[model samples]
Target chain A: MACFLVPTTEAIVTTIATKIIEKKEKEAVSTELEQGVELSSLHRERFSVKLNRLNHLLWGGSLLLAFEHFWHGEIQPFFPFLTAAGNPADWAEALHEMSTVGVGMAVLVTCVWGVHTWVLDRIAQREGMAQHEEQARRAIRK
Target chain B: MTLLITILAAVVTSCIWYSSARARRLKTGVLCSMFWGASLMWLVDAVAEYIELGAAYFTPAAQDMLNDAFLGFSVIVLALTVWVVLLFVKDPDGVVRSALHNQRS
Candidate 1:
């Protein structure tokens, strides 16, 4: 009944991590600027941005699932929050579901995001290589 | 049955997202992830039910099946609503911005 909680937990962790990494990214960018690095050449997507994407996916899915659970009356706006948490037997079932379904969803979303990140990285690398080649050609012509 | 419906939606949305640039621009990937997550949850629930009920799991009451179908459709509708809101906020093509700019002028 509380399968959404797993991803919600993940979302919270990622959200905090995103904020921390974003601050670090800002500091790093400022330092690079102080070292005379061109901001235009700092075109790579920040890790925090990638983490934010995963956070978005997790939070969005968890929100919809939580809404669905509430719609089905599996969730309550009261103490314990989950209808299944009222009794020991049902609480055990809820835990089982959380361990299985909830964990499965969290893992699946992470795997998909991992693949998407890899693809994005590949695209960025190719574009960077192409830009370097173009600059080299212009230099030769000059 | 609900699991099947959600899985089907996830697969269809993923295919659309992969094949269409506009769908990607609109962030259909978000919808895909939602559907996929729900589908996996339901799949696990189904397996648990099957284990507990054996052959009876395959013979759910018609009313239960109907209710499950409605829940499945409702989940899809809710996901679409959320995705629409995201698109409006993002305004990928600057559609809302342009409309507002035109109105102001």
Candidate 2:
């Protein structure tokens, strides 16, 4: 329910994706009569490159964050599984907390992702149809 | 700390996944995976800490909790910073590049 914390990232990513999809769809329809599959491949490749770049950034930043946390003494070398607790009750409580929070967050993220996919697909479909109509009109005028 | 961190990570991860799924671009997937990975890491940490602290884990001192919150916030900020940098580097829509070229012309 508290998903509005990062509106900037959402807005930037959305705008960029919309622009790329529109451009690629227009190009595919106008230039290639029967190479629809190739256009799909190209679209996939665009995403791959973007994802790869993000992955590099993610890894680099994560390592730095980890080191910082280590310095702060929040993270121990033994970490999640191997750290020693004082008793069974404390261990159980921690496990309970982790499962409840971790799993809850996972579910929430999945739901948001699902909604985003649905909405974007609808928008893309509508835009594609509009483009098709414009192309048909040009052909008739010629 | 673990709880807060996981929730925030999940939120960012979902946003990234949605962007990737809809645009069919890998643009945000890296961010998504990173957050999810971090969440997993914290999950392990929580489990380990619980095992160590047993019942006392439920009643952590105020200072420790505060520290965890700060660390969690820092992680989220760092992730966002990285994402922003990648956006500039890739300039997926070439908006940055075009703006520069236009200014030069």
Candidate 3:
């Protein structure tokens, strides 16, 4: 299956940025910003470890399913020869077809994962910065 | 071919897991996990098929445990991903209001 997170993540970030962070950055919602997160106070290292483990397990898990599909006579059996583009009439033909598109699909998946991770990193940084600023402002107010 | 497939699956899974775990801790939700997990799954199977081109390389020791593990992981993670995403989309303001909002209340 296609990785759904690239678009989903982008959509989420875009919405949050446009409606929430952007307004704060522009000083358009100063009141809400003051009431929202005191960003820097977050302890994120613990969270990071949890996310990393989850990613590895899930990615591996996905591959395992695909393996099962072929091993158990799902896609691989039908394709037969492993060729690309058109469907094969037998297992031999399906095997041949697998060479071209399979690799490409793998690369596509890795790339999507990379991009999604990149966005997550950015989100973490943004949250950290916001928290820091909030803490500083509170300190000054005191 | 099976040996290579096993190796491919192990390496890719480890990398994805490590990277994604880091992302999850820092970011807000489970989007990265689902995307990364699904992508990695496809990659492992795709590579195995590609390498199986040489019948001589196929081995006898494929791990059946992998299937069970993956199935369990996918179901749990996807469910969590869906729940988290819906929560974020439906009430964008709630998360930022308080850390307690994030708790399983």
Candidate 4:
């Protein structure tokens, strides 16, 4: 649950926030330049492309993890809580195991994905600032 | 049953990933994440069952197997519905906006 929810929440928040921030920045830059400079579509396009790539990486990584677990026989075929066992004791045991191991794995995966997104966001921010500085310098020179 | 669930989730996730990759968009990222999450959830469930059942895990009652299949299908449908809602809200391409404007005009 965490694996899915964490990334989905992060993506939605970041994507919307980034869009808002970009719009504000564009407006500010435009006012400052007084139409002397036009915002380059390239930077926006690059950001979009980079974000898409990151999404792909996250998806692919998760898929690979699932496959690896499956290969290791760590994943078998059984539904615990949903199925009633012949022995009530067995059902209780299954529930206990799931709550512990299942929850732990979900938390672990969510944290890893959160860290990945943070690192990627930082890189994108740094690159974006650098590009803006270069553009400013070029404008001054011109 | 858990294995089948995992496989089904994987297949859907892959399809979404492939389409998103071709379009070079992250619009379906949420959907992929949801399915992957569900897959992982089921994977852990499977492991626990195997641990409990040991060798007997391979042989499940026919009725129980059917119930599991129903549960798996329910999960897939739920995930798909959630994804569709997210996509509608996001409206990345502004199609919704365009349609609204056209209607008003």
Best by lDDT: 1
In candidate 4 the C-alpha lDDT for residue B88 amounts to 72
**Which candidate should be chosen as best, given DockQ against the real structure?**
1
lDDT of 3 by residue, B1-105 (tens): 333344344455446546775433433244334434544544555465558655643433356446644544544454456646655565555654466656746
The CAPRI-style docking tier of model 4 reads: incorrect
Off by over 4 Å in 3: A1-68, A71-99, B1-105
lDDT of each: 0.85, 0.56, 0.47, 0.57
Pairs of colliding residues, candidate 4: none
Residue B74 deviation, candidate 4, in Å?
1.3
Off by over 4 Å in 2: A1-67, A70-142, B19-26
Q: Which candidate, 1 or 4, would have the higher TM-score against the true structure?
A: 1
lDDT of 1 by residue, B7-31 (tens): 8899999999999999999899888
Second chain only: TM-score per model? 0.94, 0.80, 0.31, 0.82
lDDT of 4 by residue, B1-105 (tens): 745775677676778678666432545666665556555555665676688899898899999888767666666666567666766787777778899999999
The local lDDT score (0 to 100) that residue B95 gets in candidate 2 is: 83
Residue B77, model 2: lDDT of 77
Query: Native-vs-model 1 lDDT?
Result: 0.85
DockQ of model 4, rounded to 2 decimals: 0.07
Show the lowest summed lDDT stretch of 10 residues, model 4 chain A: A1-10
Model 3 C-alpha lDDT per residue in residues A1-79, reported as the tens digit of each score = 2222233343344344445544444463356467785543334443334334344434434444444444454534453
